[model samples]
Target: MLANRVSKRLLVGLQPVFKTPHVLPSSYLSAQNARKFSISSKCYQEQSPEPSDGESSASKKKDEGSRYYVPSSQKRKPLSRVTIGSSTDNARFRRASDTIEFSSWKAGILFVTLGTGLYFFFRYQKEKMDLQRNEESNRGYGKPLIGGPFNLIDQDGNPFSSDNLLNKFSLVYFGFTHCPDICPDELDKMSACLDILKSKYNIDIQPIFITCDPARDSPEILKEYLYEFHKDIIGLTGPYEDIKNICKAYRVYFSTPPDLKPGQDYLVDHSIYFYLMDKDGEFIDALGRNYTEETMAEHIKNHVDAFVSKEIREKRKQGWFSFLY
Candidate 1:
């Protein structure tokens, strides 16, 4: 009985101490409580019996239906991503795709461009060759075969023919004296070019004026009219039929006015140009209204220089062959 009383007294004292508020900080009290709970839970688990194999298998089957439990094969691995988005790379990828898909388009464009270039190149070469051939023919190597045989009368009542075209280069003008402005201006230009060639380059040129209106410009009338111009100018006039034939040979165009009286004042329309012929009466070239006196002189000088140089070269070749022989 005494021992029982002692035990009851000890429990009474411990209960008062357990009921008292803790003097430790909240973190320290929490740590102490968690340690006590962990020790109690460990002892309880140790005392409990292990489950049987059947119970363990049943629990595993129940876990299989759970959302958290997935098969190894179906489990997803964490994705390791590398960001490569930028303007330059995006453009590069787009270009590569376009090139691959549109390779035929690119090839077709290249083929067209190359074909066009080659066509133009060959055409240009052909035109250049044609021009060179024409130049060679005109320079007397081969005959252009223009300015055929003709017979006509001069302003001084003398016979004129294609034979007169030889011994010197001829500047032939085909027009009428009645052409008020254009004829006078062209004649003045011709006279000025002749003066320039004589004074500047010391080159002599023969200027011949052929009338398209031979009916109006008689020999005596032409002689009187030509007296007003340069002394070096030679005037020519002939019957209408003869003049027409000569103009046709020169490829010159002229047309009379509408039907009217025989002596009526009318303008004869004609193509205007100064025809330059070689000493052999072959067509060299024509000078249009565009040529100034000095410019025409220079052009003539160039032709003369080329002719002289060609002659010199031919003489040298002949001399060399003779010496070799």
Candidate 2:
């Protein structure tokens, strides 16, 4: 009985500690209410009905709670289909691109063509200017220092003087009919040159042969000798003093034996040059043994083409731009 009483006292002491069905704290109860409210809000949102087209948006807003509700101003709008450009705009853009491409192609061709044309034009102008300069350099100013008036008898025994040389170009050569090699060769070259000038350029030039050995080469002898080379060549012979004067005037050097016996075979030494005289009987140029027939013809042609009359030159000298002439 004493043991049972001790056990009963122990149970009574523990009962006070485990009493009133273990009531929870206020903080725990508030947390449980918040959890239940969140779960209910989620269920309401999920179970809400989609509004019909005839349903008023105001009524739908009124059914939602403040925590989940959104104002009309803050609501997101539905996405709309967007268009960039119209078909007409695309077609116009394509046309513009094609036009630009075509125009660029045409412009490139024009640029190349224009550049080539300009290049050739400038090149031609430069060449023409150079030719003009060359012509001017060859055609000197003022009267020539070489040829002058002289008198001599022709192969036909006709009286010819410097006046006969007017209105034509003349090539004068001082030689003797007794010349064995050099004179004949030079005469042949001159003949060929004359033929070329006449046939190719249609320019006429007079060829004259003056005798250094006047005593041996009489008018008849000269005629026969020159006819063997070219019918165009004219032979001239005169007195010894006249021959000496003519040679001195033309600046030709010639020598014959001082004292020669009659019937003595001798060769006269003379200068080898063909004097080119213009229409005015003035010296223009001199051709040596070295010049070829073709080259000599070309030189004569150039001189003829560049010829300016003495009257024209004197007229130009009176002009305001005389110095330039």
- Which model scores highest in TM-score? 2
C-alpha TM-score for every candidate = 0.53, 0.59
TM-score, model 2 to reference:
0.59
Q: Residue-wise lDDT of candidate 2 within 1-325, one digit each (tens)? A: 3334443466454432322222544554355345434444454566655533322432333344244544476453321111223345334334445443433778789889999999999996665545434444444555435667789999999999999899999999999999989999999999999999999999999999999999999999999999988899999999999999899888899999878999999999999999988787777777898899999999888777766667776787799877764
Residue-pair clashes per candidate: 0, 0
The C-alpha RMSD of each candidate to the native structure, in angstroms, is: 31.6, 33.3
State the displacement of the C-alpha of residue 189, model 1, in Å, after optimal TM-score superposition.
0.6
Off by over 4 Å in 2: 1-144
User: What lDDT is reached at residue 75 by model 1?
Assistant: 46
Which residue pairs collide in model 1, if any? none
Candidate 1, residues 9-94, lDDT tens digits: the string is: 66454431332115544654455455434433443355435533433433333333232333487443321111233335334334
